[model samples]
Target chain A: MASFIDFRNPPGSDRRADNAVRATAEPRWVRRTLIGIVLGFFALFLFLPLAVVFQGALAKGSGVLIQAFTDHDILHSVQMTLVVALIAVPANTAFGIAAAWAVTRYRFTGRALLMALIDLPLWVSPVIGGLIYVLLYGRRGYFGPWLSAHDIRIIFALPGMVMATTFVTFPFVARSLIPLMQAQGVEEEEAALTLGAGGFQILRRITLPKIRWGLFYGVILCNARAMGEFGAVSVVSAKISGKTNTMPLEIERLYNDYLFPQAFAVAAALALLALLTLVLKTLTEFENARQLEASRRVTLETTIEPPSAA
Target chain B: MAHKKHVLPGFGISLGWSVTWVSLLVILPLAALAGKTAAGGWHHFWETVTDPEVVATYRVSFGISLIAALINGIFGFLAAWIFVRYEFPGRRLLEAATDLPFALPTAVAGIALTALYSPNEWIGKWLEPHGIKVAFAPLGVLIAMIFIGFPFVVRAVQPVIADLSADVEEAAACLGASRWQTIRRVILPPLLPAILTGVIMSYGRAVGEYGSIVFISGNIPFQTEITPLMIVQKLEQYDYTGAAALGFTMLAASLVIVLIGNRLQAWGNRFRKHA
Candidate 1:
């Protein structure tokens, strides 16, 4: 408790003493009003709508909610969403780590361009992301005739859905990993190499452990997006009830059918998933902060020691 | 020269895989879209893009996006200020809540917002008596834009606020500057760049937003209709050329915004260094 207070209000410092005074200096009514305004803004804009989703879902009954989930078509949509996410997340994880490794571990030409290319998906509209697949593989598209000649389906099918999800989520894991790995530098891996470790051995024993938290966070984000993706997946999906519709698409379909309870119930399920992602996100943020502090300390010590030795 | 080589092995393999994967997934698809547009000839593309309905979408999308981003800029900054400055109950929860929009599916956000703002719904029921229509109106589109774009501003500004030392503020206070003057002359100058970047990014995102706005906007042509929705409508109608043209236009606009934002951010960094 003493150490904790010291951390918050460090001793023997003018700045800390100033902060201690400022913390309580704000007028009480002013603080209360500000808090009320912020709370009201969040409550109306965010919390109320989230509450409405649950309230609407359960307005009918628990039995109807169960039926909604078990319906043949909705079940298929849920499964399809799972399958796409399952495929996309792991693939992007590999791509992310590889990209992070390349860019951070080596000095290469076009590295900046590669970084910008990874961020391209962020700029492109999700609808355009889906449309790109259609332009490539739709019946009227460039590869359409060739694909049809071979009796292979791409667009408006499962493969196309997977492709679009991958495109939209391409940057997530890579974006997360790049900063972490770049901060770690290549010194540790070089040390392991000098110790006669093989490449796979070095990666497993040295690199992977260092990046595990970042990798985990990336997968969490990538999976959330893969499961939640609507626009790109919708464009590529044929929207056939049991065949191609993902969870988000099915929610729209059910709502359009005026099946309000069922629609919100499924949305409630996704809301739970979003909540889960939030929990994982907050935990990873804590871990990442700790890791950053540790790494910064190590870098500081190394820099100082090297200078003194020289 | 020899020391310039990477210490680790398999640089070639990793780089090869990353470039190949990105090319096949991201670069190729975008190229395909652009290629298809080019193959259709410039006249047809121009005609599709400049169609009056398409032009109306341009106006509605960019106009609402700009207005919504501006609102978010102010409110998001205020919210960030509350988070940074105050030690209140539920502060952590509210901070996490700010990320709700980002974590929630856009589709889910759309329907939920619609449900709340529909004429007979909770808030909407109260507003309807006063002659305000939120759901299925242009107002609803603006709301969705604000919902999705709020996080960009908060996340962008929070770090800068946190990095700012309180000692500086105290120094200004000791120098006999009034609170308002200190905020204007000492505080706002450094924060202006971050706020601008946040607003620009939020605008870019709002302009491209589709899934959330789709359920709320009522999809009315010449009113709530947005460019992305129109592109989807064209796709549904099997007008791939029209869809491509619309998508291309949005993509080009977003790219220009991002490029300009990057330049501005670099300039901001330089300004900070000089300051």
Candidate 2:
């Protein structure tokens, strides 16, 4: 996520470079016009929808918005969304760290294949991500009859929803962490081990601090996706009112029922969450840039060794 | 760089966990779908995929998605160029806004887009007078896809554009090339792979997208119906095998797109090296 931003010029050089380009770049009128068009494009496509979410939510006044939020079904959906995130985020974070550690720290056979397998979820559609679960656990599924005999409802239940969300978000933490971890390498941990620190000690005292931001960024992404997951959850949820309906599903139900204000109210809430996620993403990215600059400066001053061969 | 040795202690534990978790959560379920898809034998699979209605759904899904991706590719490039090359008030805010599609829930996007483009809505009402129906039409599918896919293109291309050095452009200018010539000759070639990647990702995402497109498309069978929606309808009817067949088709298509993208990117890299 941090690497998504390309601050090609060092921090100190950006201003001077911007000035240099501004002096000799395209005409002011042309530049202004282009900028206006770009901004307008964003305003229409991005900002306008965002505004509509709120406008529609507030259409019936603040009282309706409150009533919508206070609706029992909507409240249950919110709780369900939180519950899903609470379970999924930590699970994925652990998996991400483990996968990143294994892939980055060791050289082995089929390593490329393992990384590719991790990326499989990224290519799989969210709809299919849900559908696969149905294929595995729905009434007609291979394990369906058995699970039903045992009275364990995996599909059309919370477990099914959690599984679908987990599957859909499986790659976020790992994807974000792998590159950062690969670049980090295992040298620091190796150094700590050489100094007689135990495995857990090195991980806790050295590695955790270094990779905490990446982990947090990945967790945020995972959490956002998990909480907002719709297509996949929709398939397995069976839309059993408050029982299986997540917030997004609730919003969809409301909209489909012509409960426009209620739908937009919930959407506004989700949109706020999205905005918060974006804010966190920006902060993490900025902090990552700062850290990268600091580390580079440190390396230049020492000039004795690089951290990792890669 | 070549892979290096490490002294990590939990390699076995971590690797084992990764394989087990991924296999259980993702691999096994997908394999089950694939297995079920083939359960009816190759002939059944062929007939399902070749069904004319299914075929038309595929065409509509991929066709509109491709167009949307292409639109994103062009506009996204321009947007990336603006973000990377210019300094202006609210630039950071607007640049951040590009990622709204990524963060916003697909359902929210679908509804917002539906409202914005419905004949009774603001933008839709204005366009309605011109016979350009958006909501409940195939055009609505394109707009929904564009709304959802715009970020992939912008995100893919922005870094490359930003990483580009000003010195190269200045050198091109000093060599008596016009700005357009400089961009065409020096800028675009390297950016092509990124653009292609973005387009492929956008296409793949749009193809599989359901939550957002479900509302906007109006789900008129054989007209505005999409593959994912068709699959859901199958699921609703308890047609597990049928749904799996459609889902498997989508999966195969995505895999092929990914493979092609990888090959093209590799080819691009080789060409760069040779040059």
Candidate 3:
């Protein structure tokens, strides 16, 4: 029942473990030399192919690169991507704040199931998410007959893209908010309620301030995921180039057609976006991971407040 | 901050809210798929689901995912081990770089891997000389899966390894146990649970993975086609029923895998406690 080996004892085969360390430690002076070697591997593995595509795009020189940015099709796709993220992220954040408040603050039937359901999108491929919409709203889909009777254009349309993106990205906001709410607990909410503040007032005055940073964090991630979403968008979009293509789908199209340069330019842009979002996520993740820290902050606030009145 | 003298139960409201979201987010989409498949009637649905090419594609995807997950599990663990046990120069950089897969778009990852390992490229050229066809082959699918899946295992195992106190390993050595024996008997047992968690997570991710695989897979029907890819293909054909049917099937299979993987994780945790 106890640990198989206690840490109280010295490490076994000190000589061998040390030897192992030494063996790996070789090229320490050569480490910087190998920095390129390792980064070369990563660059070769991660960046080079993208670079190759970018280079191919640049084959026509700076003119093509400029042309890529100004191209109507590329511009439309870029604009559409920004529009979706801008719209979806804030809407999702509002939804998430409410959902996180409800789920964490209240114990209800099917709570666990809801938690599981929220994670479903992360598990299901985005492609499936896309197809689900088509099955539901496409011409002959489940509700397709009814919706079509109403002249509703659900598939191969912008609205459809937005809806699918929303569904696929439905999890992030709530997920990000849940841990924060869970960590913060309801002491503050209770305090506000006792002060005669209504639910909405308490939420605005107390809850929002506590979790504004977390909400912002969630929004950033939701935006990143929304912007980069490919399989689902690719599936639903008509591949109408300038009309429907997001950056990801555009990259896929160019790569598929061996238009490496244009493809990589977009891919490079995506990589840059991914890098930016990653930095943001890291900052939020640091904030999120400190479960105790949030609680400690809450505790500190309460400690500084007046003791409960008679 | 609101301090409640007494708060009324808000179960109904929260429950209603949760059901609304779940219905909209998860159940509705899937139900529509199932409904569509069922609308075709069982006979037609059976025929569609059993299409030989469709079945073959499913097999290729499943088989390649298994292969890729296994490969990643092995190297992923070793990479985790090297990163955990050995602290040399550039350690933090390497550790940070391990998360590159998380940052890299799957599509970008696919192209990068394909370019690097394709038969014509510098690395792929050597691989081709060895008659190992990558890019646009099943092998390429495995490579992408491995690339994307590596981070899961490494990330999962790293924290657990860090939490392991050096005292236990020292105790094993004090018993005159060899380093290998200590690692196998003492270290490996506890690590198995975390390792299994990583493996299952990676497997699930690999199974659902699309962006990364599509590029390298060449999307060859009946060859390198993945389940998710197949769903997309079906949707492309306007075979809404078939796509939903396949999606439901994959959903069920993955759900089962996840449940079983969870049980294994629980069992592993029990072992760690008992160990």
Candidate 4:
């Protein structure tokens, strides 16, 4: 109990008394000093490596880094990355919202197994996912002949690359949106139906506003992962240098050829963007909590159970 | 998602849509790998998977991933602790830095780390006489794995750490417990589940990671080569059957890891319920 008061009443207050007795009397200082050393350890273990990468990236002048951005291959990579993210993220978002709604709004059989199957890609290695696409659509893939007969090129091509990315990253938004929708309570929608709000109107007016933050969070995550994907992209894309190479593939090529500065600089930009997304993620929750809580209270107020009059 | 998707008849419809998409796009390809591997017949498939190069790559990949995940587990915990417990200059920046591995293309992360730690580089020069090389070696693979893997642990543990009531620890201190004792008895026990969960996830991610590791790992067979690299090599050989064989082998191992992960998660959920 005495230790309790000393520990919690304040910090750095009574520690001096322990210090006075510490000379020749205790190695408690050693243990406490070890706690102080934790900071140094954190810097070495976590921050130092990251700092090294950052330093390597910035060692080249901004002009050089920016110039790398316009080099035709780098630009092609960037353009392809953005093009894919632009297309894939929105597609996933729409899929996510529709899927989130379905999962949360309805009750039916086979739902349990279906949820597991949806989560399958998350468990499947990205490399394996690429191989799977190859298997399904490659020259000897099950449908390869069918696809080729139609003059459809899905492997070693842009369409193939995009399809691979889309499959691997599909679940990000739906997983994010489903829980938020579930918690918002289904009763309000029931009330909306009683008032003849119609399905689409209820969604636009009610659900979209409520789940927007979650959706935003999901979309940002989806975009980041989509932009950064490598293994799946590597497998299916043929990595045709200027044509199919994205930032990640470009990084590998540059490094393979020993172009260190340029590669790090490009990577640094993507890392910076990802870091920004996480910061947004932290901000999102507080904003989401406040919005959801406010609307939830509103929902409860209108929950009069249809006012049964005998 | 704010409004109920009231139009759908049941959860089955959405689940069906999601499953069908992930299945056709994700699973069917994998199933094709299986089909192709089968095409090679058992003897040839076994030979392809167990080829010295292929097995060596898996050994290096698994070995480095295990080491990196362990290292990241320790530091990732500390980073999470700092993010949750401390307020300091650049705290938010550090928190954001942890996500670098996730956002930055793995290719970039691999390259940046390689440049920084390459033998002739700034930090490496200091350790060169002592003979530590960071780039284009097995160690570089470990370094890259650490970079791309830490975010999983940090992000997984951060929220749970934040939601942990500080009062519980305070109460332990209010008793006669030493700070260490309080942390062990009061703090670490609840944290173990989350930490373990994070560790398992990061381990799984590192096991499968290809891009970040590829640039730094030198891709030297019997040294820094990884399983994914082996798969790529097979494709390069125009030995599609061999590539399919190797890919299926790794796919099987990853599924085992995934199943183990699911079991760990289920156990954690049960423990949470009991707690």
Q: Who wins the TM-score comparison?
A: 1
Better of 1 and 3 by TM-score: 1
Residue pairs of candidate 2 with colliding backbone atoms: none
Runs in model 3 deviating more than 4 A are A1-60, A289-291, A297-310, B1-18, B82-85, B268-275
Candidate closer to the true structure by TM-score (higher is better), 2 or 4: 2
Error of 4 at A74 (Å): 2.2
Best by lDDT: 1
Give each model's whole-structure lDDT. Answer: 0.86, 0.84, 0.73, 0.73
TM score of chain A per candidate: 0.89, 0.89, 0.80, 0.84
lDDT of 2 by residue, B1-275 (tens): 67655566887888899988988997899889988898867877788778888888887789999999999888888888888877788989988788889899999998998888889997999999999988899999998898888998888888777666656666776677776687788889888988888888888888888888888899887888899887888899998888899899899899998887787668656655554
lDDT of prediction 3: 0.73
Model 3 / residue A99 / CA error / Å:
2.0
Alpha-carbon interface RMSD for all candidates, in angstroms: 3.5, 4.0, 5.2, 5.5
Q: Model 2: residues >4 Å from true position, as ranges?
A: A1-24, A299-310, B1-6, B267-275
Give the clashing pairs for model 1. none
Looking at candidate 1 chain B, the ten consecutive residues that score lowest on lDDT are: B161-170
Instruction: For candidate 4, give the lDDT of residue A202.
Output: 77
Provide the lowest-lDDT 10-residue window in model 4 chain B: B1-10
- Give DockQ per model, in order: 0.56, 0.56, 0.40, 0.42
**lDDT, candidate 1, A1-310, per-residue tens:** 0111221223334666645444323434555787788898899888987998899899998999989988999999999999999999999999998899999988777999999999988877899989999988988888989999999999999999999999999899999999999888888899899999988888889999998999999999899889999989989889988888999999999999999998998899898899899889989999998998898898889878763644
